[model samples]
Target chain A: MNFDFGFAIVAAVIVVSALFVVRAANLIHAVLWLGVTLLGTAALYAQLNAPFLAGVQVLTYVGGVVTLMIFGVMVTRRHDGIDVVAQTEGADRGFIFASALFVVLALVTWKSAPHVPNPAPVASSADIARALLGEYLIGFEVLSLLLLAAIVGAVVLVRRRDPEPAGEPSPAAAAVSEVNP
Target chain B: MNEFLQGGLYGGGIIVAIMSSLLFVLWTERKMAARMQSRIGPTFTDPLGFLQAPADVLKLLQKEDIIPEKADRALFNNAPLLGATVAIAGAAVVPFSATIVGADLEVGVLYLLAVGALGVLPVFAAGWGSNNKFALLGAMRAIAQSVSYEVPLVLAALVPVILAGSMKLSDIVAYQSSHHWLVVWPFFLGIPAFGLFMLAMLAESNRIPFDIPEAESELVAGITTEYTGMKFGLFYMAEYLHTVIASAVASALFLGGYDGPIAPGLWWMVLKTGLLVVAIYWLRWSLLRFRSDQLMALCWRWLVPSGVVLVVGAAVWVVFAG
Candidate 1:
C-alpha cells in the first residue's frame, strides 16, 4: 500500500472518531471514541517518521489519559440507571465558538505556509534524549518538578487527615447502628 | 514489496508460534499450580494433559454464544479479540535472535511498552459493555492497577535503555552480551529495576498477588463474569500471551536475550523466557493476592521511586564509565 493512502485512511478514521467523540450520547462511548481518535493521531505520528513520538502518544494519551477519563466517567456516573444519556446544552453558542476557533486555526495555518512542505527530519530516540538531557536539561528538570508538584498536590488533596479508630464503626456498621439503635 | 511479503510471512509465523506456545504455557501453569497445591492436574486428554489447551478451546468454540440483554453488543463482542490483538502485538518488537524480530523499529522498547499499555482498554470495554456491576468493578480495579504499575514498569525498563544508550531491544541485548546481563551489571541498580519490572509485569498481566481485577472469590471472575464460551477463552489466552510476552521482553532486557555460552541462538532466548515463565507461575501459585490499597501503595510508594533512582543511577554510570 502507498504511504499516502495509509495516511489518508488514518486521517479519515481520526476525523470520524473525533466526530463521534463529541456527538456520542453516552459518555463512556464518547471516551472510547476519543481513544480511537488518539490512536489515529498516534498512527499519524508513525507515518510522519516519528515512531518514538507515536509510541509515547499511544502510551501516555491513549493508555494513561483515556483510561483515566473512562475511570472518571465510571466513578462519577449515577448508578441508579443504566446507560445514562449525556446531556447536551448550549448548542448554538457552542457551535458559534467552535466555528470561530476553527476559523482562527485555519487562518493561522494558511498564513504560516501555503507552499509544498518538506518532511521534517526524524530524530532518533537517542538524539531526543541527548537534546533533552543536554541542551534542554533545565526545561526537562522543570517539567519533572512540575509533575512532582502535581502528584504531591493530588496526594495531599486525597489524603485522610486522621486514621479511623479501630473501635469506630465502619460506614456499613454505622448504618446498622442507625437501624438497630 | 519483497520486504513487505517477507514481513507478512514472518508475522504469520510469529502469530502461529505464539498461539502454540500459549497452549504449552497454559498446560505448564496448570500442572505447576496443581503440583504446588498437591493435586493432580489434567491427565486424561493426552500425555499429562498436553492437549488440554486445545481441548478447552474446542469446548469453548462449541458452547452457546450468549450476549447479555442490556449489554452493548458491538463492544461486548469485540473486546476479547481486541485484547488478544494487543497482547500478541507486544511480542512484535521482541528480538528472539539477531534476525528474528517482527518489526525492528528504532523505538522498539517504547513500542512494546506502548502496546502492553493498550491491554487494559479491552478489559475496560468488556466490563462496561457487559452491563454487569461486578464486571464494571473488576474492570475499574484492573485499569487502576495496570495504569499505576505502568509508571514503574516504564521507569524500570528505562534503566536498560539508559545503559544501552538506545531504546532498541537489539541494542539493549547487544549491550548485555558485551558487558554483562543487566540483572548483574551495576548489580545494585540492575537487580532492583529487574525486581520492580517483574512486579510490574505480574500486575500488568493480572497474575496472582495482583489479580484483583478478576478475584474469583470477590468479583466472580471479574470482567469475564459476563463473558461466555470462546469470548472468555480469548481473554484467558490474552492473559497467557501477555505473560509470555512480558517474560520474553524481560529476558531480552535483563537476561542477555539470545546470548549464551554455547552458540547463541533462538533456544537461548526460549530457555531464558521459559525460566522466567516458570518463575512467574511459581509466584502465581505461591503468593496471596494484595488488597487494592496495598497494591497501589507498593507501586507508588516503593516501586516508582526506586525506578526513578535506578534510571538516574544508570544515566550517571553510563556517563562516568563510558
Candidate 2:
C-alpha cells in the first residue's frame, strides 16, 4: 500500500480516461469516459486513505451525475455526433496550450504544497463523522438545507405544463427523465 | 508475494463459491415461480432440473456471438463483461462469515454502494453501443431506476452502519452478534429501513416488479437487445449475481449473520444468505412489475422519505440507547 505502483497505474487510468472524455466524438462514449475518469479519481482517493471520500466520489460522480448525463444524452433527438468540440479546426492548438498551462499550474502547486503522499491515515470515517456531527453540525445542516432549496427551485422552475391539447404526440421526451427514476 | 498469492487464491475461491451458488438460486426461482404461477417448470436437467440454470447458461454461451453491424465496437464488446465484473467485485467486501472475506475494507458499506452505482454505467454503455433505439430506451430505464433507487438504498444501508457505528461489514456483523440484529433492534427503526432496503434491492437488481428496464413486452430485453451468445448470458448472469451479492449484504446488515446455533459460523452465514435469496425471489414472483412512471413515483413519494425518517430515527436511537 505504501508503494507507488498502484498510484502510477491509477493516475494513468485517470489521465487516459480524461483524455478520451475530451476526444470522444460520441456523446455517450464521452459520458462513459467521464465515468471512468471519475472512478480512477476515486481510486486515487482510496490510495490517499480518504476511503469515504473515494466511495462518495464513485457514488455521486460516476453513479449519479454520469448516469444523469447519459440519460440526458440519450433522451436527446440524437446520441452521436453530439461532441463536435474535438473535431473543429484549431482545437489541437487550444488543447496543447491548455495542457501546457495545466502542467505549469501543477508544477507551481507542487512546489508550494506540503508533500504527504503517505499521510498517516488520520482522516478515518469516524474522525470525519465526529467533526461534522459535533463541531460543524450547523454548517452541515445548513448545507443540506441549501441543497434542498436547490432541488425545490429546480422542480418549481421546470414544473410540467398541463397536458398538450389532445391528440398531440405528447412531450414524452420529458418523461424520458423517468428513465432514471 | 506469498501473502498476495494467498489472498488472491482466497478471493478466487469466494468467486467460485458465488458462481456455483448461482445455479442453486436459479433452480429455486424456477421452482418457486412455477409454483406461484400454477404451471410446471423445468423438471429434467439434473434430477428435478437442479442444474438447469447452468445448462441454460451453457446453451446461451454456445450460441454464436452476434455483434450488430452498426454497433460501437469497443463498448458493445466489453460492457456486459464489465457488468458481470462489477457484480463480482462488490462481493469482495462481503464477509461470508466471521473469517471469510476477500477484502475487509474499513469502508465496506460505502464501497458496496459505490460498486452498486457503477452497475448503471455498463448497461448504459451497452445500450449506447448497440445503436438500437429500444436498447437506448432500456438502458435509459436502467440508469434511471438504479440512480433513483440508489438514494433510498444508500440511506437504508446507512441505518445499519449508523446502528453498528461502523461501515465495515464484519464490524456490523459483530455488533449484531453482541446486540440485537439491527433490523430487530432500535425499537421501530429497523423494520422500515429493512423494508426500504428490500425494495431498493429489487429495483437495483432489476428484478420483477421493478423490471421495467427490461420489460420484455416494451423494450425487447432492454439493454441486452443487441447482445447475443455469451454477452447476453453475461448480462443475465450479472442480474442474478447482483441479487445474490445484494442478498449477502442484506444478511450481513439485517440478519444475525453467522449467529445461529449448533453450526459452524460459515454455515450459518450461508444459510441466512440462502434464505434471503429465496425470499427475494418470492417477492419478485408475488408482486406485479411497476410501470416506469409508477416506479419513480413509488421511489420519490414513499421509499425515499421513509428511508430518511428511518435513518434519522436509527441515528438518534444509536446515540441514546446503544
DockQ of structure 2: 0.78
Task: List, residue by residue over B1-322, the lDDT tens digit for candidate 1.
Answer: 6988988999999989988888888888999989999999998897689988888889999999999999999899999999999999988999999989898889998998899788888998999899998998998898888888888999989899888888889998999899998887788878888888999988987889899999999999999998889999999888888889899999999889999988999999999999999999898888888878879988989989988888889889989985
Off by over 4 Å in 1: A1-3, A79-84, A89-111, A114-117, A164-181
> What lDDT is reached at residue B119 by model 2?
89
Going through the candidates in order, state the TM-score of chain A alone for each one: 0.80, 0.76
Candidate 1 residues A1-181, lDDT tens each? Answer: 3367887899899999998988889898899999999999999999888898999999999998998898788777776765567877897898899999999998988898646365767788878888999999999999999999999999999999997877876787579579989
lDDT of 2 by residue, A2-95 (tens): 6589889999999999888887877677888899899899988888888999999998898888887876765674447553333545887988
Off by over 4 Å in 2: A1-3, A76-89, A113-117, A163-181
Q: Worst lDDT window (10 residues) for model 1 chain B?
A: B182-191
By DockQ, the best candidate is: 2
TM-score of every model?
0.91, 0.90
Name every residue pair that clashes in candidate 1.
none
Q: Where is the poorest 10-residue window by lDDT in model 2 chain A?
A: A77-86
